[model samples]
Target: MGHDKSGINNELFFGEKNAFSKKYEAILYNESKALSPSAKVYFNQINAFLAMKKGKADLAYTHMQRIRVLYSWYPEIKENNYNEYLRSNRNLCIVLMHQKRFEEATEVIDQLQKP
Candidate 1:
C-alpha cells in the first residue's frame, strides 16, 4: 500500500473526478457504520492516507493516531500487530517530516526498520 496506487485507477481520486477523495470518503464514513469497531479502523487508515495525499499532514496524523485507540477497542487487535506498526510509523514519519522534525522523523523511519 505504498500510495502511488496506479492499480486503484477506478477510484475517483485519479481522473477528472479528482475532487472525489472527499466524495468517496463520505462513502467510507457511511460504510464504517456497518463495520465492527475492529473493521472500522480501516476508515481511519483510509482517511489518513487521503489527508497525506492532500497535504494535510496534521489531520493525517490525527487519523493515524486514532488507530491506537481503535486497536485497543478490542482485545482481538493484539498488542502490536505488524501492519499496525507499519501503518502508524509510516504515517507518523510523514507527519514528522512535514513539521520539519527531521531528527524525529528519522528516528521513526529507523524504528520502522526494526525487527
Candidate 2:
C-alpha cells in the first residue's frame, strides 16, 4: 500500500477489522526472521498503522516508540527520503493526543517541529 499524506496506507494495510492486525503480525514476524533492521522498522510502522486503525491507542504508542528507536540508530534511514517518517511521527502525535497522553504527544510534536 502506498502512503497517503498522513503517511499511512490509503487502503487498509492488512484488511478490514481485525484482519489487518493478523496479517500485519504475520508479515512482521516473517520479516523479522531475516534480521533486516530496515525491514523490521518498516513493518513496525505497518503494525502501528494497524493498531491505530483498530483504536488500540496503547499498542499504537508502543509501535511508534519502536519506530523512534529504530530511527535513532539507522544511518541509512537518515540518508533516505524521510518524508514518510515525518508524516508517521505527526500521525503518532495525533493518536497520542486522542488518547489524552498530552505530555507524550507534546514531546512528539516538539520533535517534529525541530529542524
Candidate 3:
C-alpha cells in the first residue's frame, strides 16, 4: 500500500495509548514492509515517529535525514509522495528545535515556505 493507504492513520486515530508502547507501531509498519518492500519509504516516517515519541530527537532527526537521502535517490518518490515528504520535514524541524539546532530548524522552515 502507498502512504495514503497505510495503517498508520488507523493506529494513530484508534489505537489505545498503552498499545503504542514497546515500538508497537514500528513493528506493525515493519510487518507491512515484509509484505511489500515498496513500503520502505513509509518506514522513514515510522522510525521518526517512534524516535520522537521516545523523546530521542536526535534519532528522529537522523531518520528524517535518511529520508532526505532516499528522496534524493528517488526524485519520483519525492514528487509522487510530496505530502509524506512535507510531514517528514515538519518532523525534522520539530526534532531540530528539540535538539537546540535553531538555525537548522529555521532553514527547514524556510525550505518549507518555498513552492
Candidate 4:
C-alpha cells in the first residue's frame, strides 16, 4: 500500500464499527481469554500502518521491527506464519525506503529472498 494522504484519510473511520484503531486494538488485547502471540504480532503490524497514517514514520518503523522480535518468541512462528513474516518484512522495507535508507531496505529484500 502506498503512503498517500488520501489513502490514510480513507482508512480512518469517523463513526461506529471500530471508531479508532486503538479502540479495536484494546478489544483485541483484553477481550480474549488468552491473547495469542500471533495476535500480538498482528497488532504491531496494524499499529505500524496506523502510525504511518498519523505521520509517525519513526514509530511505524519501530512497530514493524517489533514484529520480528515477536515471531522469535515461538520458533515455529516464522515457518507457520510465513506469509505474514514476508508482509512485515516488506512493510519494514517500505518504511526504510521512505526514510532514504536504501541499503537497509536492500538488506531486508536480500533476507526475504533467501531459501
The lDDT leader among the candidates is: 4
- lDDT per residue, candidate 3, 1-115, as tens digits? 2124554654444334455554565564453543432355567677787777666788778778877777778778778877877877887888888899999989988977887
Better of 2 and 4 by TM-score: 4
Q: Candidate 1 on 9-111: residue-level lDDT in tens?
A: 5435444367865566566665356377655677777777777776788888788677757665764664546676466677777787887979988986775
Evaluated at residue 50, the lDDT of candidate 4 is 71
Q: Write the per-residue lDDT of candidate 2 for residues 48-87, one digit (tens) a residue.
A: 7767866798887888888788788885774585886787
Q: Pick the candidate with the highest TM-score.
A: 4
lDDT (tens digit, per residue) of candidate 4 on 40-83? 78778777887786778898898888787887777587889688
Q: Candidate 1: list runs displaced more than 4 Å.
A: 1-23, 30-34, 79-81, 102-115
The estimated TM-scores of all candidates read 0.60, 0.69, 0.65, 0.73
lDDT of each: 0.67, 0.73, 0.70, 0.75
| Candidate 1 global TM-score | 0.60
Of 1 and 4, the candidate ranking higher by TM-score: 4
Residue 46 CA displacement from its true place in model 1, Å = 0.4
Pick by TM-score: 2 or 3, better one: 2
Query: What clash pairs does model 1 have?
Result: none
Model 4 misplaced stretches (Cα beyond 4 Å): 1-22, 25-34
For model 3, state the Cα shift of residue 63 in Å. Answer: 0.7
Off by over 4 Å in 3: 1-38, 112-115
**lDDT pick, better of 3 and 4:** 4
Displacement of the residue 41 alpha carbon in candidate 1, Å: 1.6
